[model samples]
Target chain A: MADFATIGQQFVQFYYNTFDVDRKNLAGLYRDNSMLTFESAAVAGTAGIIEKLVSLPFQKVEHRVDTLDAQPSSEAGGILVLVTGALKVDEEQKPMSYTQVFQLNPDGAGSYYIFNDIFKIIYSAA
Target chain B: MADFATIGQQFVQFYYNTFDVDRKNLAGLYRDNSMLTFESAAVAGTAGIIEKLVSLPFQKVEHRVDTLDAQPSSEAGGILVLVTGALKVDEEQKPMSYTQVFQLNPDGAGSYYIFNDIFKIIYSAA
Candidate 1:
């Protein structure tokens, strides 16, 4: 599953890079019907997704991914990726840890776009 | 918040209960378009989902949920729930741990149905 691993790592890297610099560039990663859940709020469409990212309280943010697992789906050309990471926003607030899952649908050869994304800040389960 | 917590707990209990005895009863929880990811396989439609469950090698299975976190979604009637648990298939095989996430969309007043679910076995990150 090198393809899965490579594509997963590449997509994660591209996502965080774009999220840090040109949030707008991330638009192409989603379709009009894509669903993104930030915290608990669900946003739909490319415009809404971009707006949600750009409107984050922190202007400068960085994500450090700890664990990334990708699995090909039974659905034609679909992939499931799970990411666990910590996000540092600006320099003041404490870094927040998160777990995110994404369902990707193939857009083209070796290319996939996010179809469903669920992101949550990890509050201790204990 | 209470509503979310209550519904989350109730659903989890109801799910495991039905999963143990009458697996068919779980059918009402899903729609034709609902997506359930079992390991890396994605199954759609209620019939497909039920088939996947019953086809499991284990006949008598039990699930013990450890963490159940629920958040209300921005969607008018959607709820996002994350579950971490352990499952024992039978007397012979060792227990398997798992993490599952579910997106529930409102079906009727105070009623919801699973729209998307992702389930994975934990093999350890370290």
Candidate 2:
């Protein structure tokens, strides 16, 4: 049921939804084994990923994903999207720049998985 | 003529091929405007890509792409591969660890273009 066009829209919402923490909504987007390998941390499963979002110290975190190209292999039951964008992290004063890649499993429901995701974060000097 | 399986195989060969500079061979992989948005460098076109490869200061650099899942949309003429791996860089003494995502163009002849590529570079403690 999930096609690349549908998958692409979800991706945009997924990244931009960080504008405000929607725990319940966000949780629905991932699979049980939705591994999140961040630049500084790698967390496995939905529980682990939940912990990171709940424990983040930042007052505000903004992630913008632009220039997206997605490929959803209906036969393979998975999808991949490449996003050229930036992430603005506050409180810790991190660089808000990045080019990101997200791999998703658009499965029937919650069992979907994120096999891999790669992002380049750029930081500014004080 | 290129399928996901074929594209996947080429992906591995492409990354590993970087171990040694193969400009002519590498040149055949991308489209005319194959934009490369590296962690630190952004090069566009075959000429630009070639120029970057020809001017690297490092004596040795290694890129390892593992755990690949590729989707080639024969209907779309584009293939996207999600790779979980690391990059080892020398001379600059930086972190070689990373999880990368590559968007490739497996077009006819040399007509393919990379829409986007994102990589995370992990640096070691000094």
Best prediction by DockQ: 2
Give the alpha-carbon lDDT of every model.
Answer: 0.74, 0.56
B6-114 per-residue lDDT for model 2 (tens digits): 7666766765675455444566555555656555466777777767766766656666554455544334455555555555556544434444566665455654545
For candidate 2, give the DockQ: 0.11
- Where does candidate 2 chain A have its weakest 10-residue lDDT segment? A117-126
* Model 2 interface root-mean-square deviation: 9.0
What does DockQ give for each predicted structure?
0.10, 0.11
Return model 2's CA RMSD, one decimal. Answer: 9.0
- Give the total clashing residue pairs for model 2: 3
Candidate 1 global CA lDDT score: 0.74
* Interface RMSD over true interface Cα atoms for each candidate: 6.4, 9.0
Clashing pairs in 2: B31-B112, B95-B122, B95-B123
Candidate 1, residue B105: CA error in Å? 0.4
